[model samples]
Target: MDAAIEQPTVARLITAENREVPVSATLRYRAHDPLAVFVDFPAEAALDGEAVTWTFARSLLDQGLRAPAGHGDVRIWPYGGTRTVLEFHSPHGLALLQFQAAALRRFLQHSYQTVPAGQEDVGAVVERGLSALFDEV
Candidate 1:
């Protein structure tokens, strides 16, 4: 299984005044199971990095897309970097979480590869991804 997602990556929250704040220890997702993501932080954390998980179910995830919101907006790969970005906007502010592309791909390859392109549902895709991780190499 990929361990990178479990590691403490930096979670930055950009305020209205363009200030960066650390709101969580790490924003984690297990395989393709966005719902299984663990958001470790305070309720009063001010910003939300985990909201990106909802985008998968909401059909808002894309390589270079932004969804407008009240506070800021959600953006994915705004810079077209090697890393996949998940940006979340809340009434409080914006949260940005970066994921290493390689680890993320490995973590979810089974889901994306096994399912027909466009036929992926959140749960089945995630189950396949997790099974791949648990399966022997």
Candidate 2:
């Protein structure tokens, strides 16, 4: 008997938005799966820092990626000050997402500025950003 192997799905990097920040800043995404996605933004563009790196990793785990279908989990890791890893896990399989340093910075800024009122969803802004990256708009 022959064993079948599942091929790893290639994740696509997407830019949600771009702006000049005395340099340049952008919001990007890499889809790990239908349930999980990765997001990135610049920390400093000129020089990525630890705080910026940590914030982006935390936000992706704390926000961004979600299992709208209700069947997966998103995981994140900060790689030095240049990148963040987002992983999605489900009964079916796993997916990995990566974000650029600049994009992550922009995302963290947007995420912190907006806070929902009582009974309102706080994740709406993040969701919209993700949707934009996915071209769901």
Candidate 3:
């Protein structure tokens, strides 16, 4: 974590489908790789501090989702629950990565809307959600 990288920020936004959701966005990086920017999100909104961190990490490893170049990888960790690690590769390096809290909120909200309610195995849904987001952009 760098002194310049601010703490995670939370915001509410409407998705493409017009659904509103809350999203928390954070910028992170390794001390040695301060130039690389890693963006992280909570697995579930409204989660307890510990559980939120855990799911964030779990979502990465279990989901295998990666961000586009210049956007640092995503990481999830646990404060209480089992930490999940979801990392995205950025060949262009972290300096190119920018944290857009609004975009993240939209991405997440759209992801949930696209997912079938009550259906687990969100990996596929996540992929679809991200693809859709990129397409719209």
Candidate 4:
């Protein structure tokens, strides 16, 4: 049988206006290391080349959020699901997306504790992933 880590999955990045961005995303969970995702975009008008990649780790997301308490115009949880939802506001519009993270959770659980393993532990996984691009969301 093929190794699970060698496999990849798809996820949808949605917007408030119903616009969306489909991403080829993956996760890697290394022992004594942090949790992170590798996102690849297939050439789109809003984004750059087909090789446009946006990668970030779980620690990065955990440290950046102050939600339910964040005094701002938005909130998000990027690493909070097998099928995760990322919702945040942007200068152009409200950007939101739903993604598959089951493989991600398996990878991280191999040696790290990246995503919360509960139906209600979602915090700010999505906002952190999108914050690098979107402004003030």
The lDDT leader among the candidates is 1
Runs in model 1 deviating more than 4 A are 1-53, 57-73, 78-81, 120-137
As a whole number from 0 to 100, the lDDT of residue 33 in candidate 3 is 26
Return the candidate ranking by lDDT, descending.
Answer: 1, 4, 3, 2
TM-score of each: 0.40, 0.35, 0.28, 0.43
Give the lDDT of residue 108 in candidate 4.
47
For 9-86, candidate 4 gives per-residue lDDT tens digits of: 566777446776676654443222224444444466244344444445544433333222222433435444345454
Q: List the lowest-lDDT window of 10 residues for candidate 3.
A: 76-85
RMSD of 2: 17.2
lDDT for 127 in candidate 3 is: 78
Tens-digit lDDT track of model 3 for 20-103: 466665644232222133455555642344322312332242233233211145542221232122333335322112224344
Clash numbers, per candidate: 0, 10, 12, 10
Off by over 4 Å in 2: 1-72, 116-137
Error of 1 at 97 (Å): 1.6
lDDT of 2 by residue, 1-137 (tens): 21111212222232234321232323322222212223322444213342121113333443433321222365555555665555555464554445553454454443333321232243654686688899964
Better of 1 and 3 by lDDT: 1
Ranking by TM-score: 4, 1, 2, 3
Q: Give candidate 4 regions above 4 Å deviation.
A: 1-7, 19-22, 28-37, 44-46, 60-82, 87-95, 111-137
Candidate 4 clashing pairs, residues 3+ apart or interchain: 13-97, 14-96, 14-97, 77-124, 77-125, 77-126, 78-124, 78-125, 78-126, 79-125
Highest TM-score: give the candidate number.
Answer: 4
Residue-wise lDDT of candidate 1 within 6-115, one digit each (tens)?
Answer: 43444556566777666454444444454343445555563343322333322233233232222236555533445555676666555665555444444344334433
